[model samples]
Target: MAGWEVRPSDPGRARRRRMLGLLLVLCLPLAFYAGGLWQQYKAPAAVVGALPVTVQDEQLLAEVEELRQRLLVLSSAEKVSQQANEQSRLTIKLLEEQIYKQQQDLASYKGVLAPASRREGLRIRTFELQATDRPDYFRYKILLSRVGKGDTPLEGQLQVAIVGKQGDQDVTHELSALTVDVPEAAPTQSLAFAFKHFQAIPEADRFAELKVPEGFIPREIRVRAEVQGEKPLVRTFKWNKEE
Candidate 1:
């Protein structure tokens, strides 16, 4: 007869086997999902092509630098042009002033040569004072003219005095006292003159300079002309310097 074998069963071991089977069943979906994610991560990515550079773009790049250089050159040229224009304007202004001065001198000469309506005898035409480089030193000029067409030379003595204040007292300084150089033969008090039509003081060949005394404030000038056979003429002029 065939022998029948019977073994004892463990309840805890059977329970453990069933739990493992259930856990395996639960993990099946997670494993499948993880495998799909891995596949996507390993796949190659799509590429994008770069834009092509044209000839016109390259030309523009070269022109940008060239234009910058040209702009700098043009700026310098403009500055130079402006400076030249300013210089030209200044030169024109100076020339105009010279022309005006010349015209005035011409008019004065004409008046002296032909005075249709003027008093006869020696008359003061112009008196001018120009400051020198030295302080309180000046160059003075006096223009004397005789009216009418008389060819006879007029003889006279001119006296100049500076009227101003010295300290608090009013004072007068004669030309003789202020003259820098005094002639040995000429009178020390007055300047003698002999001219037919017109004459300038100290003559054109000589230099006449006056030194103003220290602490002397001048206001106006007093000129006196004592001509032979004529009444003494006295004239006053405000103290001013020639430009």
Candidate 2:
């Protein structure tokens, strides 16, 4: 039989191979752990830098809110100031109207009392038509003044007529015919007047409110004073509406 040749194994080489395999396994775990730590570190740097921007944004929002509140307050103040100015204007207008009325009254009284302004016979001092709240109604005022004639009171029958257009036709209406209902003490057919110096139409009431017929446009007013034992005094005035 032929003798077989024996091959010898190297223990050092086997040991070195085993040690290299163990090192590779350990290094894989260490590399994974280091990569996770690096990602965490890089992300935090960017996050930390953004903190200043967030603080600035909060400060800007606060400033905007403060400005909005200031604007609102200013707007409220301006509105109040406008209202006050409007009220002041209205007050001034009312005062001016009062002053004008007082001046007119003073002039009227002076005309009646002054000797140089005296007239001998019955005089139609003033005749005015004022608009009432109703569109088809009016308030009228007539003042009669007398001077130097007599201590005896003058008596008269006052007749008033209005000439106007009624639907393309000329129409005339007597004051008594258009007169509204009145108390028994008041005159019905015609206004009666008896006064020493001055007399106002509708002696009891300051003015009389007359209803104008529909479709009638007034143009002129005629007044006749039929005084006892004296010639009648007739006066005509163009119709003009006062305020």
The whole-model lDDT of each prediction reads 0.76, 0.77
Error of 1 at 191 (Å): 0.7
Question: Candidate 2, 215: how far from true, in Å?
Answer: 0.4
Candidate number achieving the greatest TM-score relative to the actual structure? 1
Model 2 stretches with alpha carbons more than 4 Å out: 1-108, 114-119, 183-188, 241-243
lDDT of each residue in 68-183, candidate 1, tens digit only: 99999999999999999989976865665455445445544665677567776777766667666578998676777776777789898889888899999999988778878777
Q: How far is candidate 1 from the true structure (C-alpha RMSD, Å)?
A: 14.7
The root-mean-square deviation over C-alpha atoms between each candidate and the true structure, in angstroms, is 14.7, 8.9
Clashing pairs in 2: none
TM-score against native, each model: 0.53, 0.52
Q: How many backbone clashes does candidate 1 have?
A: 0
lDDT of 2 by residue, 104-160 (tens): 455546655668555576776666676655799876767776755468887888888
